[model samples]
Target: MPERALRNNSTPAELAVWHRISRFRPAFTRQLVEAPFIIDLACRQAKLAVEFDGSQHLDSVERDARRTAYLQSKGWTVIRLWNSDVLANPDGATLHVLEKAAECLGGTHPQPLPSREGRER
Candidate 1:
């Protein structure tokens, strides 16, 4: 199995929530670092990962710490968000996740070519 498949073991709420946030047209894929065991979401191009932590995560300090360390070792910047936080403020969390991904991408992600919308300034 791939690395991502081993990572994302999020709750139903988190999974459903991230599914929406992932709608953003990022520079690359949204999920692929490691799967079921993964934190939450990720942008492969940026080498950044996002985790939506609910009650379970807090209950296991050692597991969380080890996971973070593993990601860092793989050169991935990890962003964590509490379940309640995301439920209360999804927009903020999504933006934060994007920013972290951008940070990993060196902050200069190449924008896709403009559509044929006509522009002759």
Candidate 2:
């Protein structure tokens, strides 16, 4: 399917994951195109690609492995989550994504400096 169509027709698990991770720093894009593949969700700055797999994936283990290898060659960290897991525990799934993103992004994100306008003269 076309990327745009896939974005518009996201699965429930994809929607749930997106809702949780959309606010993350470095940002994430849904149905992001990466040459031959369209990532379910991707944080480009972190070089992280998140995929939500359903029963259909069980039959394509080899294909998924090849895809992972290809993405890895391009310096991307690919993480796959089961659809059932995302639906059953969105928080846990979100945390997993955050952890992987942090790993790919090299630990915690840099904190911004506090504003000085509130300080007394």
Candidate 3:
């Protein structure tokens, strides 16, 4: 599906988590296209990909595993959270994403992209 459509049709669990973490400094993109695949959510600066897996994923364990391995080989850290877990504890799900971002970025706060106003103009 197109990224925009994916965002518009996002599951309740995804919307919940997005609202919680979308304001992070380095920012995140939902349904981010990464060539052959479209990651559920990705923070490029942190090289982190977050996926909210629903029941359909249960039947695709091997496929998912290979995808994760491929992403890892490409230097991306993939984190998957169960849809029910996200719906049950959105805060925790957001925290896990933040924690993984921090870890991947090697810091608690990623250095923000400077705006024109913050640079010599």
Identify the candidate with maximal TM-score: 2
Q: What is candidate 1's lDDT per residue for 1-121, written digit by digit as tens?
A: 4545533555554665566655654643434535334545667777777776778777888988888888888877877788888878767766677666666767754344568788676
Q: How many clashing pairs per prediction, in order?
A: 15, 0, 0
The TM-scores, one per candidate, come to: 0.70, 0.89, 0.86
Off by over 4 Å in 2: 110-121
How much is 91 displaced in model 3, in angstroms? Answer: 0.8
Listing every candidate in turn, what is its Cα RMSD in Å to the true structure after a full C-alpha superposition? 4.3, 2.5, 5.0
Q: After superposing candidate 1, which stretches have Cα over 4 Å from the reference?
A: 1-19, 27-37, 109-117
lDDT score at residue 74, model 3, on the 0-100 scale? 88
lDDT of 3 at 68: 89
Clashes of 2: 0
Q: Which order, best to worst by TM-score?
A: 2, 3, 1
